[model samples]
Target: MCSPFTSLSSPTKAPSLEVVDLWFRYPRSSEWVLRGVSLRLYPGEVALIVGASGSGKTTLLRSITSVGRWIYGGELRGRVLLGGIPLEDLPLDGVRRSIQVVNQNPYTHFIEHLVGRDLLSAAVHLYGKELGRRVFARITTALKLEGLLGRRFFELSGGQLRRVAVAKALLWDPKVLVLDEPLMWLDDEGVADVVEAVRVARSLGKAVLIFEHRFARLLHLADSVYLLRGGILHSVEQDFVKKVQRSLRLSRHPQGGSGGRTTGRPLLLAEDLWFRYDKQGDWILRSLSLEVVEGVATVVYGTNGSGKSTLLKILSGYLKPSRGRLELRSRAVYVPQNVYLFFTEESVAKEFEVACRSRNLGRLCVERGVSYLRALGVDVDLEESPFNLSWGQAVRLAVAVATAASEGPAVLLLDEPFTGLTYLERLQLAESLVKLGNTYVITTSNSENLALVPSARVFKLVEGSLE
Candidate 1:
């Protein structure tokens, strides 16, 4: 076996985590997802890996952490070393204790319903009661998770959920920290919180490996940067980060061309909206009200845990408001954060077939579905399962499916649809939505998204009401 690419000067000590000639592919798959990929992550340093959608960034991380073969049942070759010891030789629990991973979808790792209970319970079990409490308190404070402890897992905004997941991993005080899209779904403030956490981890001499598209934001702190292309890891300079981000534009259509705002009656109306999980609980939406007219997109912006998702649920008719007067003139389709749950069929073809049949699109449903996906910059095969698509692709697919009918819904509600999309993907999808001429109400934490749909009516959700 040959040594992998090393960008830095000679190391004084052994790497905390090293991948040597790693190759992996899922069972029954002819194509290899990772081809002889190798990299080394040293202690007290941050390594950033950036790649386009479906470029095998997640697969590489899974291989380095041994989740590729151990959990997913894939064919794997080569070695992953943890603390100079072969990863396969170490027990599963030991591997977990030494290296902790926080995935892109933070909700997947959450076991308990309540945030405080989950952290405290795991810490106590792993570090005993006294030490666990002390550690838990420190992590929560560092991540600014004190305000989120009382909330349930489902109640958290996407950014809050990610922070909690990071705290959960930090509670173990692992030697290495792995984050997949750590800055995803975060506003500026949320980004600062995560950056601070990473700074602290590095100061304590921990190895941090980040697999993300937003590497430019963290480039200042990255000791080494790599790009994963064609299933191979190539060393890249820090300036390359800016070049790649600028060159990823995939949009072919103009943006913000929605025939301007319509001067007709509102398609949907809500007044005096009030919502809470239970009567004893605090109100999530306090007498919030909104009016959405046809042919005009509405963008609602808010920080994490500001009740943006809850408001979308209420508007989409998925959650009944505790007390509100809502009137809808047409059908409403809601696409949520976990878009995979929106698909009931086995493959993209099957899912679109069902959608086409419902819309009376006849035998052309499959072909038309594929076209819609392509227009939004998602080009997955019809036979592929929706679950197999990347997070950004899945989100774009969900949006396409939600509006696939011959006559699209009168109102479409999206909850954090642009959470994980690249800059180009966001513009493409936003332009496509405008081209469709369907009324849309989207909730997002990123302010940059507002510029994507300039003609859209913009509002801020704060203090449980639209401001």
Candidate 2:
């Protein structure tokens, strides 16, 4: 992806939270994740940091918190200041209360039952009090998570879980909040609520920093934003404009060619599948039946835990339904949640070629832009190590390998394929999918993202049913 990449311009002014001349290396890792990278954040400002997965966005956040211990072993250098004071020199407990972190995946922060425990636990840890419960209820209710007060931690939907996390953060009332890609599993409304919450924090003169890739809804909320390119932060003057441009590019990827798929029998089929995380429990998908024809794009959508990922995994043969008949005539190439790593001496391109040929997809990998690296704004690092590639690059490589190796009208299924890509990278990926035309069934959280695809039949999984 580097060859055709045009250099981006640097911002003229320093950010509010100045990070200067920082160098870090995670223990046991010979390579440096961030080298001589510097960034800044303005006070009472919401800054969006965009970068491919493992590009050091997470590292940058961890370092800011002075929680370098969370990272195996990393050497900290240069100056990190908050309100013009060295962050490292500040007291540990003071730092924790000042710069708060709401990380990815709410499950990571799960603790105790009942939402009232949110502030109670923090207060108890600090001063031992029953008063925190009432305080928690008030704040949680204000955040719109009141309905989930008595609900178990694991019982919340993805968005609800994320809300609980935010409410906890708000209850603690830190001066600065660091939300790392907070929109991971949130729906349209959830995204809006979280944005408003961030704005509220800013209203109180708190600094809010958001790291994310899906800016479809975040274009307006943030006051200032920048792209964290390979740990080098680049400010986006008009994120609002970038968001609009991104939408236009996505609109072109799928429909560039006229709609209409060739008539063909269903290559994969499922009938009346009913299952749940636990038996004797309410089923997530009930009597669900779906079909995918050869050489066409089929997108699946549903609320979080509405069986979208479950159904995709079942279709991929990774999980067998508790009770149902599932069949697939062609080899299925699945892009799972995380890209798989291989212990071998293979370049990205070479590895993709080998994987495709091993699966009899060598032809597809070669014919389409699979093996071909992007130039002039296209990627071309297929010859590099899979472990060395960024999350976005890895996703592309996996998709490329899947397409190349499958036989017949191979069933291609992607579960949240755009998870870590920037809006621009997503456009490029969506365009590549359009190039794969037919033979793909993609599942995504949002429907507007479908606008990027010209004519994908949007089938939804609502309460365990599809149409």
Candidate 3:
């Protein structure tokens, strides 16, 4: 066995991206999110930072990218170097010229409504207009984003949005590329596209640093793997990926309902469902039909842009189908992929109280919500703002708020509910859903969803129709 950080001492080579004794915490926070973290990424190499949800992986990226300092106004200590130059010494624009970042939420990366215009504008702003167009064309083609060029940014699927963000980052052609959860929300094809993009970046001698929990897809691309836990960075051999995957495997719960779906009276039914954002746009849900039965979990599996979310939105009454017959017997509450949309109240306690009160469940139900949040590993302060919670914590909190009502069984429409959750957290959620006595329709692009809820009735959404 050899030290994973041995390359840091190599005398002849300088790291393209380097962090030395870095420490950071949010403003007015006593707990340090990152403590003495040190790592070096060399040109032509891919470095991976792995951690569970809320383990400060995003915070680490923020620190490395200087967002934690200037924008976030956090207490920071330690140095981050780009091309052997201290990041503090470099102007913000100078740093941006060398480093490009793709955020975990792809929507935050775009400013324009049209995908093509956003990419072209960003590239032109970074480079000259003439050179930017050429770069945009090359990057878009490489990422297979030609079809998405004319599409509205918000209408793109999560996977498509991620691909566009990657292409946008590549347009900068910076010395270092930083991606946060780049593989998330992607189907097999989209995953391959992003993987290839990272490979190409490495081939072009660009240093790449990826923060991801989905190690299975990107482990092979990593030149070094570091685990971030409890504000500390620990080097782990890439072989540990197998152990990580194994740990993520769920032990079959006696209540688990995946392969053997129990069917009862149909709670919701859709016939010949058709939907699109606009009349001229392509149909997202083309003649799609679905039947969700009472007292059983329904899983809709599809690629990122396969209209799964669209279907969920329709079922939840957030959107109406362009043409279809829909009969929803029970009330449907939707928890979107972006869990932040679920939070309307300022504090966690207030949100819980309002949700419970809406169903006449009283303050007791609010206490139950807090207990439920703790069971899901959130343990958030009731007075704290829900917006401050981590993505995983927010998911747990939102689901708790949605289901804490005592007003009988309702249809739970969860869009990628397991997205940001750890394996244990997901397992807890799946088990909770099984016992909640609610009809649930969970949409996801990951096959692991089937394993998590074996009793779920699975439907494959392909080319806009359920198969």
Select the stronger candidate by TM-score from 2 and 3.
Answer: 3
Which of 1 and 3 is ahead in lDDT?
Answer: 3
Tens digit of per-residue lDDT, candidate 3, span 160-215? 77778877777766678898888776776767767877876776567899988766
Which whole-number lDDT from 0 to 100 does residue 213 have in model 3? Answer: 74
- Candidate 2 lDDT tens digits, 88-120: 768987677667788887777757776556546
Please give the lDDT score for candidate 1. Answer: 0.78
Q: Write the per-residue lDDT of candidate 1 for residues 1-467, one digit (tens) a residue.
A: 11112111234488888888988899899899988888888888899888887789988878877788888999888888987889888898888877999887788887899999999999899889997887777777666678999899988756667778877887776778998899976875677767876776776567899888765467777888898987888988757755644543322122553433457668898899999999999999998888888787888888877898888777878899999898877778888777777889999888888987887787666676678788877777788999998877787777677677646446888888777777667766777777667788988876656667777777888889887
The ten-residue window of minimal lDDT in model 3 covers 1-10
* TM-score of each model, in listed order: 0.71, 0.73, 0.75
Q: Point out the higher-scoring one by TM-score: 1 or 3.
A: 3
Q: lDDT score, residue 107, model 2?
A: 71
Where is model 1 poorest over a 10-residue stretch in terms of lDDT? 1-10
lDDT of 1 at 261: 44
> Candidates sorted by lDDT, descending order?
3, 1, 2
Q: Which of candidates 1 and 2 is the stronger one according to lDDT?
A: 1
